[model samples]
Target: MNTPDTHSPVLEVQSRRRPLAWLVAIALVVLAIDLGSKMWALAELADREPVRLLGGALYLSFARNTGAAFSLGSGYTLVLTLISVTVVGVIIRFASKLRSLPWGVSLGLILGGATGNLVDRFFRDPGFLRGAVIDFFSLFDPYGQVWPIFNVADMALVTGVALAVLLELTGRRIDGTRAVKERKTAGPGTRDKAEQA
Candidate 1:
């Protein structure tokens, strides 16, 4: 009787290729939504002043931020521009190394957010490549303790980071912990268990 091969190359090919495509698709979708919302905000609120969207709980106001999140380093447009470029480059370079869906989604969110903000910096008013990003979403105290105004892009980035953290913690505990245990129990000659470890 002929012995069946233990490994399937086709399964490996499908596994790797499918997930990578999914990641790229997710990234594109996020970027589309983020940019679309910003465009809508620009058209609706550009000339108008800030307005309360939820009875002072959530406010929609228009302001152009020339800095990173929360308006930090407000005048350092060149610095922010460089940072954005670097982020995009890194995302592209390391996208293939992400081993899980959660990681891919997180990276996609970050990429979309960074792209959205970078678009504003390049295209908004006051100068080319030094334009402020439009930030209108705000959560504030009733008496007007100002929270940092942010845009849709910022929202994506925040959520993505949160997801990435959760995934890393969970993955380490689940798959990684089990693999480590298997290695210790099997000692050295069990090649399959060692590989999994």
Candidate 2:
């Protein structure tokens, strides 16, 4: 009697899970960095002047954003919080289907960034779900004159979304499969040439 090959199935399962593990690891690292930076900003930059760097090209200026990234949609904190929560949920649900390394990395960054800001929205000043996000990095000016003040989470989120878009444009999919391109129909001249050949 032949024995069942249980090891093959187990190995296949592990292989499928490897990408998910990578995603989780990347996300945790991003979340930790963003949260830590925000904590440091709140402690060291409070009531202090902006810290200039790169000959004033960059400034670390503490600011509280009650809206989405770059301070957009201000005064709608609750709405933004709910939207973020929904995004996080969708990402988590889709994680189980992740099998491509690039897709995993992109989604991981987005998940981490979203979760980082969500933490602030849930626990920061003012109240739960209405709290503001801590932003400290400013470009060109300390008062966001040239660019909106942002945080690490915003950076990660933007990078992730950009990467995802590039992957999609290049025919990469989340399940490690390249999208099949449709073949062009042969023109009359081409068909005649083929027939002659």
Model number with the top TM-score: 2
lDDT of each: 0.71, 0.89
lDDT (tens digit, per residue) of candidate 1 on 36-115: 87888889987876677667788777777888876778889879888888988998887655545556677788888888
What stretches of model 1 exceed 4 Å from their correct place?
Answer: 1-7, 141-144, 171-197
Any residue pairs clashing in model 2, and if so which?
none
Predicted candidate 2 versus true structure: per-residue lDDT over 84-134, tens digit per residue: 999999989988778788888999899999999999999988999999999
Query: Residue 14 in model 1: shift from native, Å?
Result: 2.5
Residue 16 C-alpha lDDT in model 1: 52
Q: Flag regions of model 2 displaced more than 4 Å.
A: 1-11, 186-197
